[model samples]
Target: MADSEDSTTPPAVSWRAILRGTGALPPAKKTGGAPSDPALQLWRNWQANHTQVVALTRQWQRIETQLIHSVGFPQVTIRLSGEEEPKIAHSVDEIEELLADEPEAERETLIAAFDAQQKRWDEAAATLGFDAVDAELRAALDKESDFTASVPTTKAASLPGIAAKLSIVIQLGEPSPKDTEFPWPELRSALADLARLASPEAAISPL
Candidate 1:
């Protein structure tokens, strides 16, 4: 059967594009509103910084996703000094857990082996550009924290707290074989808080 014309039709033009083509009149300028109003100025700053943080968050997520897929799971094979058989760890977390279970006197040898193997994974992550994206995300988070500090009564005062947690780089080689989680829950919450606080309806008052 032949497909309907509608099925093959291109998507309709966006309302924004249509309005632009029609040459809509420019918005009216404010007559008496004070441009130097501190509350209004703070809100504007919050809005601009929030938008940039949201964009950087998305970019960070995309790069992190690619890095995770490119370097699957990290596994390490370690041979203790006196052990006849070598130990295998699928992740650095596992190595830590293993070392914790061993006696203090015997842990040094095991730790040395683990460190050697871990260095390989760290180098691998660095070579894959994890360091670059990590730095960018940290900088954005720090900027957001600074903006949050400027507004005393803003509803998103917790933005600084959220940024502190998010800025801590969770090393890539630490995830175990079954660890498939992404750091999105707190990030989404932080973004929501920023958007709400930056909206026109939210009140920003001085202390």
Candidate 2:
């Protein structure tokens, strides 16, 4: 469809959820009852932007998962002689989950430790070309890259107008050929970045 009128689109979706998922939803509207009252425009804009962010986020998550697993999330230990190395952590998500049930005092400590670990992970990722991959994706999402050139020009026509449902002649269009090459470079670069993250020298130990 040429617009945000998909029948499968969900109701009860939140603007905040879309924002958190992809950081691409339009900014929140504030103030009202003026020549340009934002409250008057919120619902329509919010839903359209929310759906886009959610769909993009799903694609990013799949690429990330595939890259991480492809690299076996390589990680290792770092220790001076006679100093015990900390447990290796591959994913921030896993580390955070482990701290979820802890008392605040202990959780805070754990979180700080994991934050340090994540920094190291990021550094390692940079060494492996992951930085480029990340930058490319962000640029594409921000529409700052040339990726928009790949958007298909002719999408399917909308459902025909009808007085009664059965009166409209709905022609079944053949499925369009999917682009297998689109976004492949971005995804491939991310795998290399993930490979660098698996390195040991840049490993961060939990305190």
TM-score of each: 0.40, 0.27
Which portions of model 1 miss their true places by more than 4 Å? 1-34, 73-97, 101-117, 153-207
Candidate 2: residue 4 lDDT (0-100): 36
How high a TM-score does candidate 2 get? 0.27
Q: List RMSD in Å for every model shown.
A: 15.3, 21.6
**For model 2, the run of ten residues with the poorest summed lDDT:** 163-172
Cα lDDT listed for each candidate: 0.45, 0.35
Task: Give the runs in model 2 whose Cα sits over 4 Å from its true position.
Answer: 1-37, 74-76, 87-207
Give the CA lDDT, 0 to 100, for residue 113 in model 2.
Answer: 65
lDDT tens digits, residues 96-133, model 1? Answer: 77667567655665556567655755676677676776
Tens-digit lDDT string for candidate 2 (1-207):
122332212121222222122222222223353212222133233334445554666665665666565543444332223547555544555545554554667646555666765666566566555666566557545641222222222121211101001110110111211223544334333322322243224232211
Model 2 alpha-carbon miss at residue 134, Å? 5.4
**Residue pair clashes in candidate 2:** 74-198
What 10-residue stretch in candidate 1 is worst by lDDT?
17-26
